[model samples]
Target chain A: MIYFDNAATSWPKPPGVTEAMVHFLEKVGANPGRSGHRPSVEAGRIVYDAREAVAELFHAPDPLRIVFGANATEALNLALRGLLRPGDHVVTSSMEHNSVMRPLRALEEQGVSLTVVPCSPQGFLSPPDLEGALRPETKLIVLNHASNVVGSLLPVREAGQIARRHGCLLLVDAAQTAGDYPIDVQTEYIDLLAFTGHKALGGPMGTGGLVIGERVPVDELEPLKRGGTGSRSEHEEQPDFLPDKCEAGTPNAVGLAGLAAGARWVLETGVEHIRAHEVRLTQQLIDGLREIPGVTVYGGLDATRQTAVVSFNVAGLEPSEVGLRLDEEYDIMCRVGLHCAPAAHRTIGTFPTGTVRFGLSYFNTPEEVETALEAVRAIARANK
Target chain B: MSYGVVLVPSTSHAIRAERVCHLAGLKVKLIPTPRQLSSNCGTALRFDWEERETVEQVLRANKVDYDEVHQLEW
Candidate 1:
């Protein structure tokens, strides 16, 4: 079977990822930082190494600021809900996944105002729209590094510059771009960033985290959860530390181990290499899919303004029906429908039914893409 | 065996969901949301089969966000 939904979650993780997970379960099985025993200490090291590895990958100056959660969506919630309060304003974009939008919408109902900058029909958010959206009450500018639907890359550096000028913190949801691109918190002036491990990082499904910049103190944001953080057990008030404040209860140690391994591979291999591979694959798909009649491809029509995600709609086929057909007929796996970013779908003019999204990963090969292309051609024919 | 699954969009939401679930006398194991179901999010909560009604009560009361619930048979 050919799996093309790497943007939602990448399967067939790197060799090191599964190995580390297996190694952790077999060699070390203890709650980290909760116990000072040798095994516990080792487990703690495993978690710390993953933290450090993630910090390095993102070029974050401090490792402790990295907080782990179940996925990027969770990390984004901790950053958004925790940092802002009543009367505060948030600036976001139309290209955000529901992970960013749902929480912001919840906050909006509770008195926090929100400004959603418009993205192009291709799902590209212009820097000027973001700049114009900012207000003195705008305490945060939250958006995605790449469109989860179309994988269009946002001008975060320009947006970051604007946020810094306005004294508003910038929080980027790197759910689709992390490990696939270079994110420097120190250089970008981004106060917060969230990434899921199962995507570009090639970690286990449960792995994801938030990278808190040194610019934002942990106490400024309210603790999202309070429980045994393996620190300050006696205090019922919750531990007051960066990771401890945000990360509650036992972490997905196995997932972390895999993330650590995946992160290490990313660092050694370099993100540029991954990007190069994806660009080639994306161009290939575009070239191939463009040949098919009655197919409308979405996002960065230029091909250079996007991540590896390519979304399109075939004439006369429901996105769901098309996805199921791909799975059944071609043994191909792809994600379809709104892709959780209803706003994005609407912005790209594919709302209601949405489009078929093919999330490309570095691990996916040209031959696999060719196979998917053939399947799409056949499906389009059948639909026509 | 019957199980209750708690649905959350992000891991952070799951963390809070688990707190609410535990308080509801429901034990939740974080399982990949059964893909047969449709969601904008990726995770789900599975609980004791017998305590489905109780878990649902807790989830609804605390507003522990969930997309859908299912009874998985073993």
Candidate 2:
């Protein structure tokens, strides 16, 4: 009954998340920004509130600059596809999720040159190595705040400084760290940050966005899709201002209502406190798994250096088999396989074979970690 | 009791304008954009015309982007 797949999506969301969505559906079910009616304005308020909450959480310059999208993947696409053009050079780390890699790979085919700075086998990206990958035409640098596979933190702030010195913008995919980590766009010099609400943000799916910093040229960044933005209806072309510039069509107001509540919960329960709790559980899980004779642990193995996710493999058993036994026999739910980050798997030396990942959250306690560790131990022993 | 309307880029801007105005102790409401103001189709913040200068100043102080401010007859 224990859920360890929080890196994919959090479960048992904080108190008001479900209630807010229910309230929106029951009382204020209306399309946001599409109409001028009272209910429409009210729904718009909910969506705007979600933007403000997400903005405040990241310490972004303005809420209006926070462009809403379906999830972090879409936001990453908006940043990568909107900003980069043919002949433009971009640099990224090898420890990136498919969200960043796939878009960049597609861009590479469209004449944009890409440089993937290799990370260590432990999935750590060195800032110097990243800076070395930059070219004269390097216009942007995209990096994940943390690796989704091993949960190893990247040197985003250092990379940001390097990017700024090179006259390049830094785009951070914070799918793994947002809400769970403290990120100040201004202080960190992050030009663009993509985040997800379903993961650590504790909200419903289909709610996430990108925070566009002041350095980005709004005029040049193109919209992913263009339609009625509920504003500038007279114009056949898209509106130049954000977020309407990036956001087109009716938004997911109900999902946003839940996002606002979930973000508020994270704010009330300070990120530092949440980070500390997750660190404790992560360290415990790592230590216990390493103690098992036939279990092979991955990543930095240091709680202070990474997130709550721990990836491992049992000897003589495939990751899929281990995952199935954990689910049906042990009643523990987790994710296995490449985790949609083949590049990261290659960096961590787990490509193709993959690994069993236990992504913990603030809601997970030491007791749950202990039980999961015992389950892993039993499985490993049986395989041995 | 005439009212002044502040036109903004989008509904998100209008919502921000209303929030900042309310925090500044000025009463404001989001109303349908009057056709005469601009061709942009979105909501506008309606406030007491007497507080026109104050509303403008508050919006500027709060960095809320507004297109134009006009006195409404309706």
Candidate 3:
């Protein structure tokens, strides 16, 4: 059986991910930073190691600047809600996942003004259009590194330069590109980077965070929830620090152990190597799908311009029907429907019907792509 | 031997300090912040008082965000 739903969460994680989680649960069953015992210290060290691994992967300046949370959604919420206040202006792109859209919509109701720059029909965001939407009160600009639906890459670095010139912060939702793409926070000028461990990072679920860059003001950012942070227990108020100010609960140490191992594997293997492999597979899939008579491919259709995800639709076949046939007959698993990014689908003109998405990963091979393409071709032919 | 403890703002900072000390060949351990040292009930990095100067230098070079330092009787 071929799995094509990696954009949701990667499966068959690299070696040591599960073992590290098991080791944490079995040998080091302790609440990290909540106690001063040896096991507790070891647990804290494990979580810190995860932070360091993620920091090193992204070239972040300090591990202390990383705040652990649930996933990219939670991190995005933290950055949006904590940083933006009433009367603040924010700008975003038309090609954004619900993670960014929902928060901004909610913030708009709370008196924060928002401007959404329209993207092209191919799901690419133009930096000039984004810069044109900026206002003097624009406090931050949130962008997704890549679209979860079509896998089209956004011009984050250009947006970063625009944000710099405008004296605003740039926040990138890297849920789709964190592990596969090379991102240097310093070079990219990303003020806030939200990443997920369960996706391309090859870690288990419930592990992800926001890496706060130096430009962001910690004093102004508020915590999503208030609780014990294993620091400043004497103070009734929260501790004003890099992570403690944002991290206020017992962290998922077990999940972090797996994340550390997964991130380390990505580092040792090199992101460039992974990208090269995925590019080959993505081009093969896109070329093969477009060759089918009734099948219509979506997005930029250029492997060099986007990620490994490919979206398509067959004439006279609904996306759900095509997905069902691929699973039952071809033993291929994929995701259909809006993919939680209605805005992106609408930008790409797939709106209501959405499209069948095949999200590839480093583990997917040329053979898998060929087989999936053949399956899609067969399904398209059957409809014809 | 009496030890000198380096107080940090958070557990993340304390763990970072301990890592820097170990890398510098200075043996250090994280202990509960001694009540006599500070009111902050967080982790503290304890080291031999004789290496107090070296500890200060290494932590400074690494830019570990330490709160303060105090010598504690063992």
Q: Mind giving the per-residue lDDT tens digits that candidate 2 earns over A33-97? A: 88889999999999989998999899986899999999999999999999999999999989999
Q: Which lDDT tens digits does candidate 3 get at residues B7-59?
A: 88877888988888899999899898787776464688999999999999998
Q: Rank the candidates by TM-score, best first.
A: 2, 3, 1
TM-score of chain A of 1: 0.98
lDDT of 3 by residue, A87-186 (tens): 9999999899999999999999999999999999999998889999999999999999999888899999999999999999999999999899899999
lDDT of each: 0.82, 0.92, 0.92
lDDT of 3 at A295: 89
Candidate 2 chain A worst ten-residue window by lDDT: A375-384
Q: Where does the lowest 10-residue lDDT sum fall in candidate 1 chain A?
A: A33-42
- In model 3, which residue pairs have backbone atoms overlapping below 3 Å? none
The residue ranges of model 2 lying beyond 4 angstroms of the native Cα positions read none
Q: Residue B17 lDDT in model 2?
A: 92
Native contacts recovered by model 1: 0.00
Q: What is candidate 2's TM-score against the reference?
A: 0.98
Tens-place lDDT digits, model 1, residues B11-51: 33444455567665666765545767554334456788888
